[model samples]
Target: MSKTNQVKEDTKSVFQNKGSRRNFLKYSGAGIATAGILLMGCEDNENMVPDLDGVVNLGSGDVGVLNYAYVLEQLEAAFYINVVTNLYRNISDVERTMMEDLRNHEVAHRDFLKAALGSNAIGELTFDFSSVNFNNRESVLATAKVFEDLGVAAYNGAGKLLQNPDFLLIAGKIVSVEARHAAAIRSILDSDPKSFAGNDVIDANGLDRAFEPAMVLNAASTFILNKINASQLPTS
Candidate 1:
């Protein structure tokens, strides 16, 4: 009857609904390949790959940022799903429940962005987390902190690139949720509720840090395998 239980039930329902072969193909692009191919032909391909330095590629304006966010969410969603599936060492029931919730949240965000972007969204990325020790608590939490912080910074950075107010509004809502996720992850790791509330993200004026899409994309390229085109984004 609790909110968490409700969320769990909803997630289960979603999985069940999509678990069928027909539904899976329907949502997973088997039915949309022709449409996707047509869209790709007209889409801008210049920004698909990162810049010459291989750090930043702003693709093209608002869509590019959305794709960037999509990529990060894909990473987070994949990581959390792996965690839930593997059940790493010393993980408690509470941790497992909370992580499942996080997994569902990430999946929702990922799907939302993919849907909103339509054909503009980047292709599915190949992630390399070999550096992360999934069985170790320290490794997992540390990686989570990095991801959450980066996600918050990414949304903050891309605000200016968004020409549509609706997109900006959606980004605001999602980033706030990401901040909460960051706070919770920090609390779990260090027992400090405010560990993630420092000047790095929050400034001396009590404002969150904002970077341009170029900068955030540059930072993110290290973790993601697929290159991003951030050149279409504003530099200043």
Candidate 2:
């Protein structure tokens, strides 16, 4: 066979063998196998502002990861604050109380990161949530669910990327709280209160989903005024 043909076949086999490879690891030792989960070839879809115009570069190393989390928290905090400060038309007292709690929780998370990172923390980000219809309950709840779920996945994915065990431990704690927020938002979204752990985020094996930095940021960038470059974040 020609060299080009052999190369094409090799590449195809590699992808095709991924499932078998994953199965082998699973059979070897489930716990150890899961620790090796790393996404390959994830594209950078963040609509980055031209560097010529000056963009926010989330510095390299552990600091970049923290800045990424901080920026996400900033977005969440701003969103919940917006919802709480301006109650929608005919929004119930129950919703008002819940939103107030969410707002406070997000604010606490954002502030904690800021304090932890000190001067390394990313600056406050401005958001463009014009697509959200605050007056409509359905619209508000749906958006909340989206953000919370994304937050959980973002934390989970970034957890493995942290070199510092302290940072990883703290990220795990934050993700747990984010998962709770996701569940609460999901419950409110569906008329049935028991729909918190929907299939969208939780799989058949009851595992939470994870997205690489680029994937998460791309999904989230639509809401923020500033774009984040997470390329410098550690992958291993």
Candidate 3:
């Protein structure tokens, strides 16, 4: 074959491969969307958000609480995945294993919330971690600390807002795991076991710090690029 013709054939082959890949992705995405819609159909409309943004909108009551948990889980899951993806230099094997465990835990939490929420569950959230320096250990751990601490406080704060006893029980279970992750991350920075659980997260009365949904969402909004309009979440 002529050299020119050979080059043209190669280009055509490349284009065909690219087109196939693009089509595959498009179909995969469509399948996921369809499944999500079907899942939403099973839930009570009263509990589901009427509109979904990049962030979830937890309408109210038990549904609201589940959405809230889902959002936090999304954040944690994203953060740890980032850590694993861009591993810092000089990271110990033990540290890597522990962080992997944390990553799995966050995934489990996110999945649990999604399953529990059923049709009432909010859509997937977009995370923005531009401020996080994945290359720097300090920056990564600091952000992890913030997320872990916020998660604990979020559950503590939302506990009272939960009307369903089963939902509250689930929250308690998830938060305890979050607390353990926080403690493990804190130990990486300090020898003190109680470093992360100090007065800031724990009040003078020995109670865990709690924030209203608005307050927790406000803090969370800073790290999340996708703005969430959680005004619909029940305050009462």
Candidate 4:
């Protein structure tokens, strides 16, 4: 077998042995209750009402930036939640726990934006995962790695566009968390736990990757159903 195939086999063995539910349960310990709590008061608030189901325009300025992050977080949170609900075959308790934590973090990020954007937030988006094989552990982890990396890159690239200092600070904080998630997923995908932030994502300058908003949205289009019109976003 080739080196790449060999690594995959090795990763499977490690995943089965190392990931146990008890180990993951120790972190955060925030369960479904916490998720529900974060979304509290949203239903009653008139401003929390979602926009139309069709193609939504992300208005310009700081609000547009918030919605952009919000849209990505929605995707991440939904993806993780789906993974937790329909876990892959042979999933270890440790892996399950890790997934649960990711779900909680994504949910927190998603709800935070939802609450912050209030009336400005776009309606919830629909997704299409036909290309993703969720039942395959490798496939699911690979997809998660992609989403996490894209999220970090999106935040990093968006920093210059945000006019509000407070919004930029918040983005910085969330991007760090997204980076951590990306690292954790990368570590789990291989035998080398130290491979958390591999060279694939970090450049020679040791900088994490970044992408233009349009490019990020285009890549995300495969899984997202909405026609995201980013034309109105601030350029200066």
Candidate 5:
């Protein structure tokens, strides 16, 4: 197999073992609660249905919050998958491993949300990273930082909107992972440890910033090809 293919296989294995263990640990306490989510996903409820009229309405209530997260995971997963497949120039061994790990983790997140959402999940989203210079290490890492930070904020903001305790618990777990990814990317860009939790994203109280669904979606719109409607999402 080619080197790229070999890398893909290695990452897949890592995800199966390491990623599974990590997510399992985070989810273990909420197993029964998560199972409830799966049951909810299986149901064909009128309120949970999105109008497919050329736009994806993220549905409503807890399902809406989930689909919102699903969209972000899909974007992050796609970006890292591309970065791994088409490695940047002069990439180091450590960087390559980091990329692979990030890719697999995002994929695992995307797939888990998809499975949890079941039929209630939105269709696959299409992304446009044409502007990203995948061949350049700086460009790739910068974009990664953007995606990771955005993912962390999106989850933080949406957590309050979820009424289901199980869903909120899972979202909190996922956001913690996303924050780690953000910090990793930040550290890579600037060896300064402070950059990992810079003042830009963290307040004086040392709390991470959160962006509401609309704000998050707006920031992410530059790369997304599909028009998403979050109007039906819960307000309070």
Candidate 6:
């Protein structure tokens, strides 16, 4: 099967598997296969990301950055999937549609990066969203805000680390989308809507917040069950 079609099928299976829902969120979460589970058979593959004592290392250069982005996309996609599937209490039609759209966008981002990375793509990641109370609308929205804002910051920070122009361009485009997602979620949660240029994420220089890979991973590792090693990623 073509790479795109293969990704579609893989994602379809994930979405259709109701039994796996328990793996994602504390309440109705859908779990994706962990790298530890998927990497057992690829021990000899030279192109695969190195697995040292179950730690999935994000290889150096643009590939590492792409894989890092892929991880965030996976987390965002899974969160939105569970949110749409279970629909928090007393959700409005507008909110439901917004969640669905966000899910689609995140899934697309996940698939695109997977396809672009091809054989170099890292294995699917497992997440522990036990902290998010999916049954409550307030809890769900607040968590969404965190993910969107973090995703935007992650992309912004990683963009500078990419050595290839094409990869940098792709990162720029994805970050813009993430910024929009952040704005949308913020608008839903806040009484006053400031859009993508919100003050919380923007500094006095009027630029969105940027987080280095280590910092981003440190913040994100709480929700991620897998051990990710970004030690090899470029710094300058």
The TM-score values for the models, in the order shown, are 0.74, 0.76, 0.77, 0.77, 0.84, 0.79
Question: Residue-wise lDDT of candidate 3 within 122-234, one digit each (tens)?
Answer: 67877889998898888888889888988888898898887766567667877887888887888797667678667767788888777787888889988776666677676
Candidate 1 positional error at 227, Å: 2.3
CA lDDT of each candidate? 0.69, 0.72, 0.72, 0.75, 0.81, 0.76
In model 5, where do residues sit more than 4 Å from their true spots?
1-44
145-184 per-residue lDDT for model 6 (tens digits): 9999999999988988987665676677678777878888
- How would you encode candidate 5's per-residue C-alpha lDDT over 113-144 as one tens digit per residue? 77667678889999999999999998999999
| Residues 56-147 of candidate 1: C-alpha lDDT, one tens digit per residue | 44367666777778888898998888778876798988888778777877877787667656656666777777788889888988888888
Where is model 5 poorest over a 10-residue stretch in terms of lDDT?
27-36
Q: Model 2 segments beyond 4 Å from truth?
A: 1-52
Q: What are the RMSDs of all candidates, in order? A: 8.6, 15.1, 14.2, 12.8, 8.7, 8.5
Clashing residue pair totals per candidate (backbone < 3 A): 7, 0, 0, 5, 0, 2
Identify the candidate with maximal lDDT. Answer: 5
Ranking by TM-score: 5, 6, 3, 4, 2, 1
In the predicted model 2, the residue pairs found to clash are none
Can you tell me which runs of candidate 6 are displaced by over 4 Å? 1-49
Question: Model 5's lDDT to the true fold?
Answer: 0.81
Question: In model 3, which residue pairs have backbone atoms overlapping below 3 Å?
Answer: none
lDDT of candidate 6 vs native? 0.76
Off by over 4 Å in 1: 1-58
Candidate 2 has what TM-score?
0.76
